[model samples]
Target: MAKFYELQRAMRAMRQSALQRGALAILDLGSTKISCLILRFDGLDPSLASDQVGSLAGQSSFRVVGSAITQSRGIEFGEISSMQEAERAIRTVLQSAQKMANLRVDHLIACFSGGGPRSYGLNGNVKIENQIVQDEDIARVLSSCDCPDIGDGREILHAQPVNFALDHRSGLVDPRGQIGNKLDVDLHMLTVRAKTIRDLAHCVKRCDLELAGVASAAYVSGRSTLVEDEQELGAVCIDFGGGSTSYSIFLKRHMIFAGSIMLGGNHVTRDISLGLRVPISVAEKIKTKNGGLIVTGLDDRDLIEVGGETGDWEHDRRTVTRSELIGIMRPRLEEILEDIRTQLEIAGFYELKSQKFVLTGGTCQTPGLDTLASRILGQQVRIGRPLRIHRLPQAYSGSTCSALVGLALFAADPQDEWWDFELPSAGYSSRTVRKAVRWLRENW
Candidate 1:
């Protein structure tokens, strides 16, 4: 809930500052790519402040002034490996983006994947004063929650209030300004190792930029890719990147569960390199150019030239059937999806009233991936692209850009949560919520 309040606050601040001449930036720190976007807000109307993200109307309010991508460094499996190296990389990428946009941005919001994070679902109830649930009342109720100590070496990444109820009614997006004596809030809090966050913050600071906010890669991916219907219904988003695959489950347009696997496209490349006895660079090029899991009779006859670095004409010239390549790739891909399936099960994903799956991120581009994933996940599956924006180049429109694009949309229309509300004594506890779930299972 605190994270939700912080995001809401940042959104309000961005809206107010949109009238300024310079651009506001969004930086996505992923395992595969570090993307930077510089946005120029043209209108004074705050409603036009954000890039439309979730609106199904396909509105055209904001335009992307400039965007750039660079190979990420000093990060492995979503965590920072070297702070100085990462900082240098951040400066280089942002400078390039600024140059392209012809604008210098003072503020930047960053997203990250690995933090050794943990999540908890918390719910609280409060009796309203004067039988009216105003914004302050909501804030008060959230404040009343005796938030747990998320451990010492960790920082709170996102404390989002996912759902709320007024009296006996549930699924209220906004309970503010409503007349009600009883108010309830369902919150999702994500906490990461403090060292991981500090490293990211230090890197951003070195780039001479203010860290407006930071978000979990999984949460941002969910925001960028999942459709409104998928969000309203229960669904999971699996973001497969270069070195890690992040997962988040959303219901009622709010995130409920989040996690990541320490495996990605890089692993696939490694597999190809080791199995085919080729260089990593060559393996990557081959994967990007001809990688696919589903084998066909046509593929058996087709041969791909395998380039060699030794430059010996006789030894360098080699060819392999497409089917042999798929043999090496399919096992790694299946392992990734299976790991995600394990996470979903642990998160009680099957308990959802609706079960749908959306796959995105760079690695999701492998041909026939959706078919392979659906067979394992056992749910309706589709590739997701970033939504709620206009003027995006068709070449940049794909599942891979969802995180970067969603970061932009999240910068626009942020939602308020329990942390923004006031806190009072004598509220419900997380244990109580868990107990209630257990009771429901026993009774229903």
Candidate 2:
């Protein structure tokens, strides 16, 4: 636990250093595409900024000075499958973005969508030593939370204090400077496959770029897609990427749960290819141009040419009705949505007072997806796009760029994680005792 906290602190310090340098790059390493964005900061403190001037109040302190994207190779399900190919792809996108910006960046903050993320909720409390809640008190309470054994091959990616409480008062966002006898905290920790993270780090190092920070794509997607009201009340943001479909639940403006299904847009494209007897490339084009969940009566009469590259003219001139395409596509989509529904139910999403579900990412661009998601997930569903950032190109302001945009916002104004506070070196052994006491107090 101590080693994990130390690593997190080091990463945080690296991110702070990159920010102080006034420039860094954001990378979204996904299954189908590799995206890079160069952001230049103006040395302005986000807390002093106005909402009207930035994407999020006190968080939009950077502008996109350059952007580049390339087709991902040797990556599957959001994990690097081939080191050489993934490295080449990363180098390509970074070089293009740097060239566009006419500046070189040595630091990068990256987000990815795979690695089998698991979420755990933990609670802890600490008695005030100085009769007032200070930074040390906050740190003590956070460190008191029991760190669960997530598994052998997994590592904690995010350890955030979602809620704080003071003595008889609860629901405090911050307890510092408050006169309280005791301080309590509810923490949300997300863990992912250790190998996946290590592979990403190795790839970045091979590209000769310093990895300043890292984040889960699901959490960052929720950060960008959910509006303040939805986040404050309660909402689920589903990110449909090419390799995976990741969803996160937010309450009180903090992520409480996050999970991902390995199935995503790539699966749908493969289904189309098999069902239509077409190549993968052709299937992708058809899926993008003609895919839909709803099949109208006129669709039966509408014909879409599924041209093949074969030299035989007649074999290349095949055509299928729109209804046929929808028939092939709907089942897989339904399966994906049903899987999401099951995960959400397991997470107790229905119990939330506000159960809005927001859909974003590249695959969510398919026509009629919002309507289909509403019927499958819930009625309170809406399609989401990334919040606007300063100087962001219109082409990159869609759902597909949600994670990238959120990463920038995160780099500017990150929430307080466990490592942000100062914990005493000797506090590790007391974690189990604190957990037992809290359990007894609540149960007895």
Candidate 3:
């Protein structure tokens, strides 16, 4: 019951505030870039019913006012390393985005990537005194859940229920008003090191803006990347950012697992920079333009002219085979996928039996990534892009924009966050638990 009351309170507060207009910023604190987007929410337009903004599944109706990205200076592995440096980088991006949008944002929702994210699947049950589940009962059951003793210096990132069941019939999308004696819930909780969140909150607080919320990059990525069917049946979204790759699994339209690997596109570039003795800039260019896992018949003959700073002819004309370049890139890519595979396995991917997978983020755009990923993941893998939105900038409409677009969606209609809903008591659990579990086991 406590959880439900908190959820209700949050919803009430949000409804009262309405978050109608002006500017709101979403700061993506990444290892490679500190991106800030300044969005001006045009007041709801009834004439355009399609554009209404609220928490509705598969419904979006917001337009971007401005967006900007800058190189991150004080972040490593997606966590803030230096507050001062990160603050400066954030200011730069915010200033540029505000200038372009002609708006100043007082509210911000920040997304972060690191701090050793861990996922736990929790089940809570309550028996209803009566034959039906009530709001209070729902709240009581959630409160009954013995909140696990997360290690010291750790904080919960996401603790939302992924699936719910009532009585012996599972797959109950919504358990409210159901004629069931018991209630059962399958929840996915994600946690991160406490210091990571503290640093992020501290940095943003110093920026002179109110922190609306903090979200996992992987969770937001899945929001924009996974198609409706993929989300419904279950799918994993791998976000290959510059500094780290974040992963999230969704089943029954709710996020069930989330994690991140320090290895990312930056590691690949570094490997190329060192292996080929090329400048970092040139290595990045090569990775972006010619990097791939699959080497073919014509690759050996293709030669790349290395660019030089001092016009030094000695280092500028070193030609390397495409196969060699692929050789350098392939292993690192495989390692990332292998890490993801391990993460999925740990999170019970085999039990899900989901054959759909989606890859998104800036690094995922590398040539031949889809083919390579398909070979490694052994699933129907595809590169994913942000869902198309009206008035989104051309530059922010690609796979890399998944998190950004999803941030907007989250603001417009956030799912029942941790503090959103309540749980039922013993009465409800006794009536619903076994039946619901049995139903889910059979359906799944």
Candidate 4:
């Protein structure tokens, strides 16, 4: 724990320096592609972000000056499978984005969808010695929470103090400066496999970039797609990426549970390749140009040319109807949705007072997916796109770029400093931790 927090402490300083320079790059690494966005700050104060921006998921006081995306290589299920290839992809994407921005950025904040994320809800309470909730009380109560055994080789990616309570009153977002006997807090902790993070960090290092901060795709995607009202109430966001699908549950403007599955849109593409006896690339193109879950009579007549290789012209130039394509896609999509449903059930989704599900990410663009999700998941379903960012290009404003745009929001958000709620342990940097809490109190 001390080791990871120290890394975060360094990242906090790096982020501050980059923000002071008025430019920073945010990268979203996924199984399908890697996207980079360079945001130019408009002389905005971090301490006044939420108040000035009005809490829109992607509406922060930052303008995207440059953006580039490249096909991901050597990544599976959002995790780096080969260090050299992943590093090459990162460098290529960064160079392109930096070229467009005409400015060099040394620091980067990255988000990824792998790591097998798991969420834990923890609570702590402590008596206030000064009869008022202060930074020390916040730290002390946070330290009092019983840390769960998250297993060996797992790293805590996010430990956000979501809810605060004072004495008999509960559900306080901030309890500082309030007179109280006891301060209680509800914290949401997200953990992932340490190897995934370590591999990503190494790849960034090899690319000659500082990994200032990292976020799970599940959590950050929810941050950008769920509106303030949906977050205030209860909402679930399913980010359907290429190799993995992540789901996050937010209530009271904080994430309570998040999980990911290895299954995603890529599996459907594989099914198409096998079912149509075509190459993976051809299947991918077919899925993108013509893919959906619901089939109509018109689809039966909609013939799609599934091009291929090999000397057999008839087989190489084979064609299939849209309905046949949908047939191959729907079953796999249903399996993925069923997995999400099972995860939600395990996480007690039905217990949420108002469950709203928002399906986003690159894979969600398949036509009629929302309708199928509504049938399998629940009636309350909507296809969500990331919130509009300031000066984002039209090409990158689709459901596919939700995580990248959301990464921009995460870079602008003070909530990334959740590690500031550290335990009062030996060698604790009290001043630094207190500074993070102050920022959250003033801005978050």
Identify the candidate with maximal TM-score.
2
Clashes of each: 12, 0, 35, 0
Q: Write the per-residue lDDT of candidate 4 for residues 206-245, one digit (tens) a residue.
A: 8788778788898888988998899999999999999999
Residue 85 lDDT (model 3): 97
Candidate 4 regions exceeding 4 Å error are: 1-11, 45-60, 416-444
Structure candidate 4, residue pairs in collision = none
Specify the highest-lDDT model's number.
Answer: 2
- Measured by TM-score, how close is model 1 to the native structure? 0.86
lDDT per residue (tens digit) for residues 207-281 in model 3? 787677678899988988898888889999999998999999888888888999999999999999988888898
Which model, 1 or 3, shows the larger TM-score? 3
Distance from true location, Cα of 407 in model 4, Å: 1.1
- Residue lDDT tens for model 2, 1-444: 556567778888888889888889999999989999999987544654644454455355678899999999888998888999999999999999999999889899989989999999988888998898887787777767778889998988887888898987988887889997888899889999999889999999998999888899999989999999999999999999999999999999899999999999999999999999999999999999988889999999989999988888987998999999999888888899999999999999998889999999999998888889889999998999998878899888989999988888888877745478777766446878899999999999
lDDT of each: 0.80, 0.88, 0.78, 0.86
Instruction: List TM-score per model, in order.
Output: 0.86, 0.92, 0.88, 0.90
Cα lDDT of candidate 1 equals 0.80
What is the lDDT for 264 in model 3? Answer: 93
> Rank by TM-score, descending?
2, 4, 3, 1
